[model samples]
Target: MSDAQFWEMNPTATEILNEVKARKIQEINAAYTAEAQPLIKEYPLVEQQSWTAQNTEARAYLAWHADQQGAAPGTPVLDNILMGRNGETGTETLQQLCLAVIENAEMFTQFQQLTGKRQRLVKAVRAAEAVEEIELISW
Candidate 1:
């Protein structure tokens, strides 16, 4: 599914989309090709492949899009302080919310495939103490 659908599913993402996008970009380009890459506009080495280059370029562009669309408010975006009443101390981060949304029973598999973070997502879902506390039901 397109990234847009992800945001659509998790409306809470709007507040911290930058964090989510930054994270997703890293996941998308963890280990790209070295030299055998695809060439979309510029040029690659003689030993490079167009398909690989194109894929890398595309992923990077998507990452750039993620950056543009989902950058945090500051350099240390993850360090935001949360304050609420009724002793609600734990601050469910945007990444955590994204993971929760990704792991929702309705679209777990789709998000796993789309984000390619199956292990992390699964682990997070399993570790979350209050998945239900984070409301994803849009109305």
Candidate 2:
């Protein structure tokens, strides 16, 4: 039912309903923040968002294709590129690359296309989130 219809059907429950909705908003925002905060600190905001978008893309691809596989999913292409570069364990290599991205920001021509894709993804995500957050605040 629509909001007006539902409210008419249960006039006495409006306060309770509002409270429940408010609590849910708080809970959802808290959950999103709790998961996002550490990564936000580690990368600049743009890179953190780029990583999230890249992860989501990779995960969706894996979900649909994993069982039909020739090879089971392994590390992401981005991780593989970094790993192959250093011959180190994945984490250290990725950390070093991320730090390099932050520090140099202009030195890696080979990675330029990959980084460009991430840059675009980050901009799009930020724009979309800005609109969503504005709407969420009205609730």
The lDDT of each candidate is 0.38, 0.48
Clashing pairs in 2: none
* Candidate 2 TM-score, true structure as reference: 0.27
The sequence of per-residue lDDT tens digits that candidate 2 reaches over residues 1-139 is 4567756765555454454454445554565456445434555765544664445445544454647556544546547557677575444544455454444333333445544554454444334433343234321
Per-residue lDDT, model 1, residue 61, is 40
Alpha carbon lDDT at 28, candidate 1: 35
Predicted candidate 1 versus true structure: per-residue lDDT over 1-139, tens digit per residue: 5568756776564434444444443443442222113211244344224333333333444454466776533312112211221136675654443333333323323433434443454344344344342222111
What's the lDDT of the predicted structure labeled candidate 1? 0.38
55 Cα displacement, candidate 1 (Å): 26
